[model samples]
Every structure is written in C-alpha cells, then in structure tokens.
Target: MEKEFNQFIEKITLTTKQKDEAKTKYTGVCKKVHDYYYDCNYDGSTKFLFGSYKLKTNIRPITKDQDVDVLIKLPQETFEKFNNYQSNGQSALLEEVKSILKEKYTTTDKIKSWGKVILLQFEDSTHNIELLPAFEQDDNSFKIPNTENGGSWEVFNPRAQIDAFNESNKNSDGLTRKICKMVKKWRNFTTSVSIKSCSIQDWAIDFLASNKVDQLEIEEILQKYFEFIRSKCSSDNKSYVETVLKRIEKAINYIDDGEENEASQEFRKIFGNEFPLVEDSSKTNSFDNNIFSTPRPWLEN
Candidate 1:
C-alpha cells in the first residue's frame, strides 16, 4: 500500500518535459513584458514565479484552467500614474497590462484581463500563464490590482506564503506537500467538493503540524486527514465530506483484511486514475469475522 501510494504521487507530478516546456513558454512571456517597460528605465528584473509551480506542489495531466502564476513588478512611476486616477485606477492598470500582452500575443484571442491578473491562455492549456502586474512597496510586499468591486489595490505577499509552506513541508518531512497534492487530486476527481487549492494546502499544513504521525504511514495519515477535515467542511459541503470519509474507511478496512487489490481500487475511486491499481494475486474470497474489526475512533456518527 505504501509503495502504491508513493507511485501514485510520482504519477501525478509534472514530468521533466512538461516543466521545461512551461518554463520556456512563461519565460518568453516574461521577456516580452520586460522589453515593453525597458525604455521607461524599468530594470526588467522584478519578475517572479509563484503559486503551486514555485511550491513544487503542482500536478500533471493538466486541465485547461491549470496555469502558472508570474508576478511582474511594474515601475514605481507607472504606479504613481495609475494611483493619480480619480477612480477605477486598478481597472485602468489591468487594461494597460492586458494591452501590452496583446501586442505580443496578437493571434491568441483569449488574452484578457481577469479579476486580479491578465490571463494569457495558450492553445496548449498546459502552457497557460496568469500574469500578475504588481507595484513593489517599501516593505517588499506587492500591490496588485483587483478590478472587481469598483477596483482596488490589494497587498500580496506570495513570498511570505511560499516561505511558510516550504518551512511547514520541511518540518513535516515533505508530508505536507504529499497530502496537499493528494487532496488536490480528490478535488479534481469530484465536482461536489468545491474547496480552493490554497485552502487545501492550508488544511494539510495545519493537520500535519497539529498531529504526530509516522511519515512512512501514508494510509494512516490519509485516514486521519479525512477524519480531521470533516468538521472543517461547510454545511453545504458536509455530505461530500461524509462520502469521502466512508470511502476511506472502506479502503482502510480492506487493507486490514489483507485485500490489497480491493483497497487500491477503493483509493482510486477517491483520488482518480493517477492512483495505480494493484494486481489481483489471489481470487479466493475467504470470509473472516475480523474484517473491518479495526477501530476507527475518530469517525463520528
């Protein structure tokens, strides 16, 4: 079971080819943005990679909306120019950035200004990039535009968030990232669970930090995770949480009963196709009274 779970993690991770392609594409986009602002005395060196890609928690078998996030720090003069606007300065800033990108991606019709970022969607969904134009503050935090709700500038500290996650993951011996990636797989597999990716990471980090579980005990960690997150689910999503808990319980029971293949199948149902299926070595169905006898005291009624 441990070996299968480890293989599943490897399967879901982005391949070397995928990483190289994504880096090449986003780097080109970054260069274009830098060139556009270079004549204005902009240093062209403030771009940064953030989100799941930077955190090394991104998954493979990419979906259309799966994208890399890039922060491009605009010149301070540009910030002053937009800040001086009487109203909707954030919207104006977004529009300006979108127009700049449009010049380079002339044929790509999906290049548009989203709520807080300019979404540069490519024909190959795996190569899509979310470009965040930001103004550097005195304290090193970034001020990004939010065009929604009459437009406003929001302080974003991706650096701090990334650092915290790295620290937690290190302390947990990489269990934090493993659990986060697994939860993301669950989110992708089911439509009923509508939790955000960031929220999933937060939950995993919090769970691992508060509990002391053996790093090698992946199954036990997952069992505890599902039990822990049930109460954290909102009223609207409680039923979905119950569904996951039941499936995990059944899988654990199968493992306890020495039904490795059956256990793998049950886990596949939760995490989707990336989870490898175990080979059925024995067809004998031996009825045992001790099946499902293992106590799961954490499961609530």
Candidate 2:
C-alpha cells in the first residue's frame, strides 16, 4: 500500500515538461508586466509565483481550467493613484492590467479582467496565468484589489502562509504536502466536492500539527485526515462529506480483510484514476453509479 501510494504521488505530480512550460509562460508574463511598469518604479524583483505552485502541492490538472497565480507588486505611485479614485478603483486597476496584457497578447481572445486578477489564458488549455497586481505594505503583506461589493482592497499575506506550510511540512517529514496533494486529487476527482484548494491545505496542516503522524503509514494518515475534515465540512457540503466517510470505511475494511486489491478499488473510488490498483485487480466501480453522480446545485449551469 505504501508503494502504491508513492506511485500515486508520482502519477499526480506535474511532469518536468509541464513545469518547464509553466515557468516559461509565467516568467514571460511577469517580464511583460515588469517592463511595462519599469519606469513607474516596478522592477523585475517585484514579481513572484504563489499559491500551490510555490508550495509544491499542486496536482496535475485533470481539466484545462487549472491556473498559475502570479503576483506583481505595483509601484507606490500607482497605488496612490488608484486609492484616490472616488469610485471603483479596484475595478479600474483590473481593467488597467488587462489593457497592459492586451498589448502583448493582442491576438489571444481569452485575455480579460476577472474580478481582481487579469487572466491570460493560453491556447494549450493548461497553466493559464492569473496575474494579480498588488501594492506591497510596510509589514510585507499585500494590498490586492477586490472588484466585488463596492470594490475594496484586501490584505493578502501569502508569503507568511507559505512559510507556515514549509515549517509544518519539514516537521512532519513531508507528510503535510503529500496529504495536501492527495486531498486535491480527491477534490479533482469528485465533481460534487467544491472545497477550495487552500482550505484543504490548511486542514491538512492543522490536522498533522495536532497529531503524532510520524508512525502512521500513508493510508492511515489519509484515513485520519478524512475523519478530521468531516467536522470542518459545513451544511452546504455535508452530504459529500458523508459519502467520503462511508467510502473510506469500506476501503479500511477491505484492507483489514487482507484484500489489498479490493482496498485499492475502494480508494480509487475516492481518489480517481490517479490511484493505482494492485496487479491483476478487477476494474473499480464507476463514479457515475455512486453518490457523486449528482452534480452540486451551483455546478449545474
């Protein structure tokens, strides 16, 4: 089971080629943003990769909708200019960034302002970059635009969050990131599970921090994580949580019965095709016939 878990991790991680492509594209976009704002006190050092990409917990995209988040620190002057606006300065800031990207990606129809970030989608349908233009604060936090409501500036401290995850991951001997990636796979596989990726990572970090996880195998750790997350699930997602708990119980029963192949099939139901079945094992049950067959109400559109 440990060997199978290792294989599953390798299978779900981004390929070297995919990582290279993402770096090339995001760096190019960062360069464009930097060069355009160079005269306005924006330098090459102001841009950075954040989110799952920076944390190294990102999973291989099951769909083309996967994205890379890039933050570009705007000059203080730019912030002051926008902050002085009496109306929706957040919306204005997004539009301005969209126009700047449009200058470089003139032919791509997918470039547009999306809420707080400027989304520059590529033709390959993978690694689309979500560019965030932010103002660096004295305390190293960021003030990013939020176009929703009457428009506002939101304080973001991803660097601190990343540091915390790094500390927890090191202390756990890498179980923090492994469990995060596993949960993300579960999220991608289950259509009705709409939990945010960051929320999943936070849960893993918190769960591992409170428990003695050093002696637990990957399967045992995963079972504990599922149990821990159930309490965190809200009324909105309780049904999905119940389904996951039931399936996890079945998998554990199979493992206890010494039916490793059957256990693998049960796990596959939770984690999707990225999880490997034992050699010569029968095909697993289809998700279409399970409780996940029904789409969440909001996803119907």
Candidate 3:
C-alpha cells in the first residue's frame, strides 16, 4: 500500500526538469507581455502568476486544457481612463490586452479570446497560457473583466487565496498542497466529480485545516479524505458525492479484506491511471490488521 501510494505521488508531481522548462517558457511569455505594455505607455501595469501554477497544485491535464493563468494589473488611473472612455470598459480592457498580444504573436500563432481570458497557444507544445486583464482597485483587490453576461467586471483577490493555501499547507506539514494535487489528478480523471478546480482547492483546504487526522501516513490522510466525502454526501443521496462515496467504500472494503491488488485497482478507478497497480504476487497479509479492518473509520455511520 505504501509503495502504491508513493508511485501515485510520483506520477502526480511535476518532475524537476519539467518545472525548469515551464519556468523558462513562462518567463519568455511574461517578457513578451511586458514589452508590449511598455511600448504602449502602460508603465504602472504589472503581471502576476496566479491559479494552480502559482499555488503549485497543478496536475497533468488529460486533454488539451493545459494552461497557465496570468493576471495583468492595470493601474487605478489607467483603469479609470478606460472606464470613462467606454461604457463597456471592462471588455474594452480585455480587447486592448488581446490586441497587444495579437500583434506580438500574430505571425507565430493565433491568440484565442474567451469570455474571461485570452489564450495564447504554443505551436509545438501542449501547454498554453491564459492572460487575464484586471484593474487594480484602491484596496489592492482586483476587478477583472468578464466578457460574459453582456460584459462586466468581477472582483477577486488571488493574493488572499494564495496566502490561505500556503498557511494551511504549513499547518498540515505541506500535506494540504499534496492533497490538492491528488484531488486535481482525481478530478481530471474522474467523470463524476464535476466540481470546479477552485472549489476543489477550497474544499481541500477546509478539510486539511479542520480535520484531526494522523498526518504521518498517506493511508490515514486518504481515509480521512474519504470520511470527509462521506460526511458531505450524507445529506444528498442523489449527488455526485454519493457516487464517489460508493467507490471509496468499495476501496476501503478491499483494504479490510487484505486484497491489496483489488484495493489498488479500486483506488485507480477513483483516482485515475496514475495510481499504481498492486500485483497479486506482491500482496502481503503481514500488515497491521488493526490499521485496516472492517468497520473502517471511513465506512462507519
């Protein structure tokens, strides 16, 4: 079980070389944006890395949805100017950013515009970058443009979210971040859990901060996670939570029966192919029966 869990972590984590390459690519993209804004006389605007990349909870995307989220912080005066010039200034700001990048990358690749962000696709890579144009408010919060719903602005503070994740991870001995990555991998591969990535991080942070569980072992942490899901599903029988609860219960049953191979397979069904497969030949009955038995903590009540 320990070996299988280790393998799962290995598969979910980005390799050192991959991280290095990603840093280089991200830096190049940021530099291009900086150059465009500089030439346009937008001196007070700055760029920030946010979302899963900044939080370090990103997993390998199963589809072509791999991307990094960046925010362009426009100064208060510039924001006011844009707003006063156009009734739908929020969307106008987005267009301004898009046009700047389009000029920079038009010869190389086409930049796709979505409702809230502009996607810059790389020709030879699966990863893309999403640039969000936002206005810096007086309180250091951000009002990002939302092109949907007839165009408007949405408030957000990525710095607060980042700080919450970092502090929670510190309290949990970095298990909060690890669990976030695991949940991302699970969500990427599972069809039942249709929750948003941001919501998933919120749920994981809440669980890590509130739950009192043994943090030394992954198995204990996973058991507590299953328990958390069970609690969330107890009130809704027809929800996706219930669907996932069934799978978690089955995995726990396999563990109780000393069927390591079956248990590993069950976990793979829940977490995806990144989970390691345990062979029948490698099964061992020498594990502490008290640690994994019937009436498991996750299965009780």
**The best candidate in terms of lDDT:** 2
Predicted model with the maximum TM-score? 1
Candidate 2 pairs with clashing backbones: none
Please provide TM-scores, in order, for all candidate models, with all chains considered together: 0.88, 0.87, 0.79
Per residue, candidate 3 scores C-alpha lDDT tens digits across 21-103 of 66666666666666754556434237788888788887764245667778876556666766675467667777777787776
Model 2, residue 287: distance off in Å is 32
Residue 62 of model 3, lDDT score: 28
The candidate, 2 or 3, that scores higher on lDDT is 2
Per-residue lDDT for 122 in model 2? 85
Q: List model 2 lDDT by residue over 13-63, tens digit each.
A: 989998898888888888888877776543458887788888988888636
For 20-117, candidate 1 gives per-residue lDDT tens digits of 99888788778788777766543437778988888888887788767898999888888889888989898998888888888878774478886998
Off by over 4 Å in 3: 39-45, 148-151, 215-217, 226-240, 282-301
The regions of model 2 sitting more than 4 angstroms off are 39-44, 280-301
What pairs collide in candidate 3? Answer: none
- Alpha-carbon shift of residue 162 in model 1 (angstroms): 0.5
Off by over 4 Å in 1: 39-44, 283-301
**Whole-model Cα lDDT per candidate?**
0.83, 0.84, 0.71
Ranking by TM-score: 1, 2, 3
